[model samples]
Target: MKKSPIETVLGILVILVAVSFVHYAATKIDVRPQDGYTVSAVFLKSGGLESGADVRISGIKVGSVTGLKLTDDYAADITMTIRDNVKLPKDTTASVASDGLMGGKFLLLEPGRAKEKLNDGDKITKTKDFKSLEDMIGDVIFLATDSGDK
Candidate 1:
């Protein structure tokens, strides 16, 4: 079978459209990670908090966790990258939070009222350590049993 000139042109148009659609899709789906300043915070326990986790403020995403390591004091040191526009106060607090009871972990940043802004490579002084579910459960059970014995 022989293809007509109109059919050949239509096939070429379809291929061009397909390629354009693919390029557009690729651009839309490609999320380039933000390049920003790094700040460290130490936590007693990370509670499964890992790198690439979201760093949110007021429930809005403003940054992300970039690195995690152990400190000499046996604590977890978390490095976060905050956007250039978001200037954090020196007294800002970093806490590990979960979306829900069984949800994934994220870093929650609570802004402080201090006049001094945190600079690049500065350490966040106020950090809330991550509390595990097992620890909370144990505490609850202890409280209930103790009350019952009374």
Candidate 2:
């Protein structure tokens, strides 16, 4: 059976749309750091922290930010999903850090020496946020002018 030219064009258009939809869905999915337990941390200030931000250890990405919310006390709570193979110590620290002078934000994890390990839903008690560039510059200026030799 011979198909009409209009039918052929419609079929091609349908296939193109399907392919485009698949590509869009795949790009939106976050498929890194395979399924693992989640840990929570509280920060005085998240400082532009958002879901999908990279979680790193010593500058190496080990996980990603899974969620963010505010606690009853007004502190920001961030949930991170880390790889199953990476077992964080009980005393580990989580801090919000920036990539560089011009880069996005991420979580920095520093493991501490502890016999115990953190379980799912465990909260990291220690955290540090990135300092504003203005604040940093002001501190440097103050130190430079406050020297006794000045």
**Best lDDT among the predictions, by candidate number:** 1
lDDT of 1 by residue, 34-138 (tens): 788999999998999989999999998889899999999899999999999999999999999999898999999999999999999999989888888888999
Tell me the deviation in Å of residue 50 in model 2: 1.0
Question: Candidate 2 lDDT (Cα, whole model)?
Answer: 0.89
Off by over 4 Å in 2: 1-34, 147-150
Estimate the overall C-alpha local distance difference test score of candidate 1: 0.92
Tens digits of lDDT, candidate 2, 1-150: 998999999999999999999999999876754588899999877888889998999988788899999999998999999989999999998888887878899999999999899999999987886676777999999989896874
Query: By summed lDDT, which 10 consecutive residues of candidate 1 come out lowest?
Result: 27-36
Query: Model 2 Cα displacement at 25 (Å)?
Result: 13
Query: C-alpha displacement of 108 in model 1, angstroms?
Result: 0.4
Q: Which segments of candidate 1 are over 4 A away from where they belong?
A: 1-30, 148-150
What is the number of backbone collisions in each predicted candidate, taken in the order shown? 0, 0
